[model samples]
Target: MVVKIIVSTDKRAVKEENGDFGFILWEILIVVFLMGIILTLATPHFGSATNQVWIRIDSANRARIEGAVQLYRIDVGVYPLSVTDLVRAPNGMSEWAGPYLDEIPINPFDNAQVYQIGTMGQVK
Candidate 1:
């Protein structure tokens, strides 16, 4: 499909001899350069935004894990021996009301690690 735009040349645009009008090369280049500069300025802010999102997700995951642990404890009369118990039934265990959690929450910052079990049952 072909669409034609008719414009007379102002300062920013150039026309062919046939008088088709749009941005000149330098004007387009300037826009692209300005966009590049804006992107460079905004890149750090975008990175921090991503970190903030991950932090929120991490905190929510930690809370979900903590809640699951609590429910597991209430049901089984003890804290889980490990986070894996949250996702899989422990061997030969009865009164195991779970797979309480779908999966163990991994540390968001370091994917290889599970959230650390810090002092006082805190997920670090």
Candidate 2:
């Protein structure tokens, strides 16, 4: 068996069949209003999620710096004078096997300073 489909090219007939063929002003306004409401509800959640992400990043960076300091102490037999020592060899250390880190990571919470190393090779 074979089936055939009939198509209409008449503008009036198509418009009448589809009943206006476009959104009215009230329909467009309703869509815009719904979108605004959705955005209003979602904005606060986005801000909180961003803050959570920053907190996690800060924790990971501190841990990484602390590990590097420990490695430096193991290799050179002394804790670094500062975080910068991880990226540069300190004076009079023949066994200084670093730039352990390519560079010290900046503290996200405080853009003005990088993470600090304490006396006992911990991140401060």
Candidate 3:
């Protein structure tokens, strides 16, 4: 007596039997590389937008400080000699009505608490 055996040549059947059903390492690496490129392209725009927001905030703070100084002058009849004069009354001035600001704001760029008073009551 004699026996015969046959084998199936289908690629899908072979793959299923071997359990090879996931991405290769090279494919994953390629995806990661593409994502890095996309992020590199987008990073500059995000940085510029953040800078613009900081600029606007600094301008608004300057305006508020200037306004407070103007109010101080209006009440006391002389411009403040320094930004601190807005918060504290100088000697011999009875018209001081405030701690004009809750706290002095710091410069965003330099992290300095100092301010320069320009001509015509502008804060720099």
Best by lDDT: 2
Clashes counted in candidate 2 amount to 0
Candidate 1, residue 124: Cα displacement in angstroms equals 2.6
Per-residue alpha-carbon lDDT of candidate 1 for residues 1-124, written as tens digits (9 for 90 to 100): 9886657655434445446857669888999999999999999999999899989989999888788888877888877767787889898779799888887777778899776554345566
lDDT of each: 0.79, 0.85, 0.81
TM-score per candidate, in order?
Answer: 0.65, 0.68, 0.77
Which sequence of candidate numbers ranks them by TM-score, best first?
A: 3, 2, 1
The runs of at least 3 residues in candidate 2 whose Cα sits more than 4 Å from the true structure, single-residue gaps closed, are 1-35
Error of 3 at 23 (Å): 1.8
- CA lDDT of 111 in candidate 1? 91
Better of 2 and 3 by TM-score: 3
Model 3 lDDT tens row, 1-124: 7764337776555666679756668889999999999999999999999899889888988998999888887888777888888877788878898777777777777785577777678897
**Over 4 Å off, model 1:** 1-36
Better of 1 and 2 by lDDT: 2
Candidate maximizing TM-score: 3
Error of 2 at 70 (Å): 0.7
TM-score of 1: 0.65
Worst 10 residues of 2 by lDDT: 4-13
